[model samples]
Target: MTEEPVPVTRAVDFGTAKLLPDVDRARAWLLTVDDAPQSYVDLDDPEHLEFEYTRRIAHVLESAFDTPVHAVHLGGGALTLPRRLALTRPGSRQWVVEADRGLAALVAEHLPLSDPDITVHTTDARAWLAAAPDASADVIVADVFHGSRVPAHLTSVEFLREAVRVLRPGGVYVANIADGAPFAFLGSQLGTVRAGFGQSADLCLLAEPGVLRGRRFGNAVLAAARRPLPLDALARSCAGDAFPARVVTGTALAALTRAPVHDATATASPVPPDGAFTVG
Candidate 1:
């Protein structure tokens, strides 16, 4: 496949593997999920490399936690965020949980994550979070996905509770999710996330309400912290420039009051009462 004449936008090699992209200038990406390899089309514009999103993530996280952070990935991609974190904060320790065995095997083939303060583990994200001890992680990134869908179990209410359970004090949870126009899953996800993290649920949508209402294309980063998240500082620190495309949060934060928490043990949860969040 390496000899097939695919454009190589960037390439590298890690301690145990060769890092390369299947194509450059736009191609396809097969993400390994809990089940199998799912496909996505890369517009091939440097603009769409999840790196843009990852960069913003790096910026917010670095500013949020001044020192190097102990990070955990519920899903692993080209390991872009982990790699960038390693470069920006040397000596950080990261654990990436990837479900696809073949995809895990191909890490060194397409990208190298091991050397960059990351340990790749093959497993389901929820199970890992559930079985782990109390407050074991400082920050948990639940960006697990294959194509546009998340594994069925991963989105369930029970799963998110465990995600929150494994986070340490002031630990934050970040999840990358996709939804259809009209944001078919947005409300319910907000509902479920509210149930999981109480008033700490904060959203960073790749698209805005009008766009999400159209539901044609959507991707968002939903973040929750054991403590209050710094949405305003993040907004200010962004220097009034949106990441990737135009995005504004000052108004949205008003509409995103924290939903009430369902019992941590319950599978299906109900949205909690108002006043759960201290609206910004």
Candidate 2:
């Protein structure tokens, strides 16, 4: 087991994050969490990012709505996806909720998500989720995390209920989860979201199913709405230049909401194999 993290207070540009090195470590982040200063904690791993999968999310959401959708981000990691959305669909309203006050400042300067349109909120992600400008946003993203797990409070059944409350009629809820090694955290989280969203489809790495590539779990962009959102066309259409991959929906979405992880064999099929299988 790795030693507990040493407190970090010094400020340094952590490459992609642009936030202080201390901020990362305190919350058990890459620059700060567990043991070594592994690159995955430093934003070196593109695969673990919301941006890597945002375009696909955007592609699907765009199809769901006739116009640009209102969006919010719970955890501000370099604001990659937010930046992408603002760029792809100009004049869009976005709110980014960051827990770490300093992280907001760091991303304000460094991360690529500096659109004058996006409003950055510095507060507990859950509070902001409830207090956010009411039924104004069309999408609500809750991707906040501490090391691998979302702070337990955030994942509690009650909190998810709150998330369902704030979302628009067909709003999309996206979550980025980290499940690796000997834990079923990923699958369980998937179950939690599935229970909440009612509709979800995974956006995982382009690899074979059940393959635990060490720290390489997968992303579950779970989307749900009080009313069904138009997702098929979104999944079929190619996202413009800025975004890549088609939006996945139907079985794909269901898979994300109810993704299965094979525990009996210790190796299972892809959580949401729809997108991958359809393409293959």
**lDDT of each structure?**
0.56, 0.51
Candidate 1 local accuracy as lDDT? Answer: 0.56
TM-score of each: 0.69, 0.60
Residue 155 error for model 1, in Å? 1.1
- Please name the candidate that would achieve the greatest TM-score relative to the true structure: 1
Which stretches of model 2 miss by more than 4 angstroms? Answer: 1-51, 111-114, 180-183, 197-216, 237-280
C-alpha displacement of 193 in model 2, angstroms? 2.9
Question: Could you give candidate 2's per-residue lDDT for residues 212-238 as a string of tens digits?
Answer: 334444443545566655555544444
Q: Write the per-residue lDDT of candidate 1 for residues 128-179, one digit (tens) a residue.
A: 7778888877888877654335656776667778887888788877766555
Worst lDDT 10-window in candidate 2: 32-41
Pairs with backbone N, CA or C atoms under 3 Å apart (clashes), candidate 2: 25-32, 30-41, 200-253, 235-247
